[model samples]
Target: MDRPDHDRASAFDADSRRRVQVLVIGGGQAGLAAGYYLRRAGLDFAILDANPAPGGAWQHYWDSLRLFSPAEYSSLPGRPMPHQTGAPYPNARHVAAYLAAYEDRYHLPVHRPVHVTGIERSPDHLTIHTSADTWHAQAVVFATGSWQRPFVPAVPGRELFTGHQLHTTGYRRAADFAGQRVVVVGGGNSGAQIAADLTAVTETRWVTRRPPHFLPDSVDGRALFELATHQVRAHAAGDTHTGVASLGDIVATAPVRAARDSGLLAAHPMFDRLSPTGPVWTDGSTWDCDTIIWCTGFRPDLAATRALEDPRIHLLGYGNWTGPASATLVGVGRTARTAVEQIRTLLG
Candidate 1:
């Protein structure tokens, strides 16, 4: 697919080729966080992001969506999100604006709208090739995050009906589907939120692969923000090597419970088949719908740098780490502070 052209793309010149201590491949929360720590440690690094603006993945969310996390919890290190005229849960635009402001405030050196096409490593440095330019660095951090690509399941006749099929990533607002019968697949947080928002303006149905455990946005006056914090602490303390196992447990207990009790969502069985008309349930039931929103999930796009054996190029830390002169992966921590600390230590 052709990339969006909101920012100018620059060509890589051999004479202009620059060397840095670290190369951050993403400009999202994780990438910026790593940059923050690297800067504090006085390390030479640069951030290359595909988006025209900072705020990372937040810019792709629906228009009416607000973060489940409050402003306080969402703030990055050494900077605070400017408060808007709203409650604790700021909408997607607000979050995006905050990240943009952060980039300006910190003077973060980021190459915007430059898509990274591939990455390779030499004996002493890493080579990052983008659509616009190439970068050479001693270490590269894949802060691209987990949500690199949207996951849409292969269903029969998916292309036939297609009135306006979109993933949660492309969904902007309920008004886009006003007065339409929409069926949203996946009962995760995104699925629930989309269904709930659409319910206010259109007929909606939520289909899931399995019964999801829902939790309230809050529990006993405590937000679920602590979950990320706890995982970061555990990883930093060497008590755990992976954060997914712990995050999965917390998500199961919290958001899963909240969504189930929302009473706005109607849980349908797994999607058994798809036709031009609509999707069929596992029990052989059919529901005619005008639009289908896939909220399945996403995966990291590491094909660009698959040849690298450095710890920096990992898939949840499951890839091979047996390369000469071990290259450390920094900023994999789940929480903001913990991720910053990890970057700090790695840089040191």
Candidate 2:
């Protein structure tokens, strides 16, 4: 992978503060997509990333995690991810490499390890406060994403749990829970996959508020994106139609499929409360488990812009609120492109 062009000297003003027409927060896939269009628009822009290296949140995901779609369907705006041999879906490392290469291929201006503290608005520009330097920009593309703030729903007696508890963020490998009873919470892909991951090495139980929903084995990220896109177009044309939810929650990935075939993927209802040792269902049934992994999901890390209400500041890649399927690799391009065009007109 080509290294990102970190030479940001040209973006600095006379006072040594960096200034640009556009400032993209988060150097992950969403921010990079925004950078691709911003670069093409001939805008003087900079991407401020909090990580010490490339790959955004992908680098932080658990091992054995794979995209639900093949690499060709999971690409950024300018290039397709190189195909992987002997695998239907690329793993997280492959994704990170693709992103880093995309940055180099496009030569996007990316500043790394630069944590953006907050955003301040002036009459004509937005001032970005960062750990390293202050940046002034005509517009800001907030693509920080949700990984920074993992969500765990408030279950009763959660604080009193004596065993280990962690969100999906801290989970790295299934081997970590070997020989122990583990409960994986949530009905999303993460929960299903994590439960699958743990089932082989340990005693595992899957829990959700409702019975888990499973998409057909034929469905993958590609199909899901297409459905979401159709829904978006339908909505724009004043048609209210069912969206991706019509399919189901979790995609039947290889691991999840295997676990299901083995009859180990059966899900239990979410526990009503937690005892010191484990969880207690509404009917007073309890299961003793050594650890709980909450895969509930995430909220957008938009705290930096929480205090400001500026029209020039655009949010991207959080979820449907930003754009349909905007959080996905292939889905973010459309939203980023439109946001850049709007930013260009606003700057002009």
Work out the TM-score per prediction. 0.79, 0.96
Candidate 2 residue 201 Cα shift, in angstroms, is 0.6
lDDT of each: 0.64, 0.89
lDDT of 2 by residue, 1-348 (tens): 334255442244446667788999999999999999998999999898888778989999999999988999999998999988887799998899889888888888888778888888879888899888888898999989999999989899999999999999999999988899999999999999999999989999899998888998999998998898898889989987658886798999988999999999999999999999999999999999999999999988987886445779899998888899999999999999999999999988
**Candidate 2: residue 96 Cα off by (Å):** 0.4
User: Could you tell me the lDDT of residue 215 within candidate 2?
Assistant: 97
> Which model scores highest in TM-score?
2
Which 10 successive residues of model 2 have the least lDDT summed? 1-10
